[model samples]
Target: MLLDTYGRIATDLRVSLTDRCNLRCTYCMPEEGLQWLGKPDLLTDDEIVRMVRIAVTLLGVKDVRFTGGEPLLRPGVVGIVERCAALEPRPRMSLTTNGIGLARTAAALRDAGLNRVNVSLDTLRPDVFQTLTRRKRHDDVIRGLEAARDAGLTPVKVNTVLMRGINDDEAPELLQWALDHGYELRFIEQMPLDAQHGWQRDDMVTADEILTSLGGRFTLTPEPDAARGHAPAERWLVDGGPARVGVIASVTRPFCRACDRTRLTADGQIRNCLFAREESDLRGPLRDGAGDEEMAELWKKAMWGKKAGSGLDDPVAFQQPERPMSAIGG
Candidate 1:
């Protein structure tokens, strides 16, 4: 396994296929969106396949998740997934999506070898959805969730970013709704990764606040630690429900100690941490015909230099990454 200096193993790789998104989520991107990278700057489908192959075969990566500005927006998404599925000792394949286009693509994605999905949904109310995403197709995301479920992506996880006054009070409703539909819910504390620099530490609804809201509605008990170390969310069981709810308290509670993941940007830079100030250029090396051994060393070297944790909890030294959430491939 690839080990960092702090003795953490690197086994999960999140690869971003593109930096283009259809929705203009207020928390994720600017209303106008970004000037996307041109095609040539992106890693070709073949390049992505080769890198993942090296990570799995040489570097001992076991989980491969595709994230993006919106992964489903990429034209070659299915092909990219197919390549990962073909890996020897096939890694668990997954994706994190906004679910706007998932209604049409979910089945194809599953058929192409995606094992599961985590869909980002802030609100079930149409008006609230429109307010958060600045989009009119709230029902489309719902339909996409249905499609993914029907395609055998069971226990479909919902990632909801919570704000102090916006949707924070909906914890019970969201939890009950998720349990009712057999969906697992995870509430993420709003972080300072927004494109518009609108994130205020005071505005974030913390994990404690979410649990407090749920506590008033139902009996919740903390789930045990995951067998695989350092799961991002803290899990809990609803007293009478079959499905579970979780919270990724990234801002208030950091889990950098057990992070076994690294990230690959759509344009081919490798990031050891989501909030990393520096990136290792893999595109140049790959294009120059670097062998797997060489490329793997680059990845290993990068991981070796990783910081202890995302130092967001430190008020005096904390600095938000230069790239916004969309560019960073959450």
Candidate 2:
């Protein structure tokens, strides 16, 4: 396994296939969207496969999560999933998507070897969704969720980004929706990854608030300490049922100490952390015919420099990453 300076093992890899997205959530991007990289600049399927090969074969990575402005927006996405699934000693593979096209793509993607999925759904209210995403595809996303479940992506995960004055009030309702529909609901504390850089600590509904609110609605109990292990989200059993909910306290309780994932941007830069400011470019070397060993070393060198945390713990010193969540992959 690849060990960072802090003794943490790097076993999870999140790859961004493209920076282009189909929606413009108020907190993630502008309504018009950002200028995307040209086709020539994005990593080709072969290049992405090669990177994953190195991460799994050489670095001992075990899980590969594909992300994007919308991974479904990438043409041949199923092909990409098929390639990753074919890796020797294949890693556990999954995808994080907005679910707009999930209704149409989930089955093919599952057949292509995707393990599970996380769909972003901040609000169940269509009006709020349009206000948040500046788009009218709320029903499409819902259909996507249903498609995912019916396609055998059981216990489909719904990621809800809770903004204090925005959709925070829907937390209880969202969790109930997930419980009733059999999707695992997870509340993510809003972070400063927006392109606008207008993220404020007060605007975030803390994990404590989420737990309290959830407890008010159901007999929520923290998933046993043993159950947590290295998973980023802190889980809790709902009404002691098989169904459960999770909260990723990125803002209030950074899980950096247990983080095992790193990211590869669509433009071919390696990011050690989601909030990492510096990125190491691998595209230059890859295009110059650098072999797998050379690329692996560059990756090792970059990861060996991993910090103890993302710096949110030190509010005075914390700085948001230069890239928005979409460009860096959600």
Local distance difference test scores for all models? 0.88, 0.90
- Candidate 2, 259-315: lDDT as tens digits: 898889999999999999999999999999999999999999999999999999888
Estimate, for each residue in 208-283, the C-alpha lDDT of model 1 and write its tens digit: 8889989998898777676325789988878944557888999888999989998999989989999888899999
Worst 10 residues of 1 by lDDT: 221-230
Error of 1 at 306 (Å): 0.4
lDDT accuracy of residue 12 in candidate 1: 93
Give me the displacement of residue 248 in model 1, in angstroms. 0.5
Q: Name the runs in model 2 displaced over 4 angstroms.
A: none
- Candidate 2 — worst ten consecutive residues by lDDT sum? 28-37
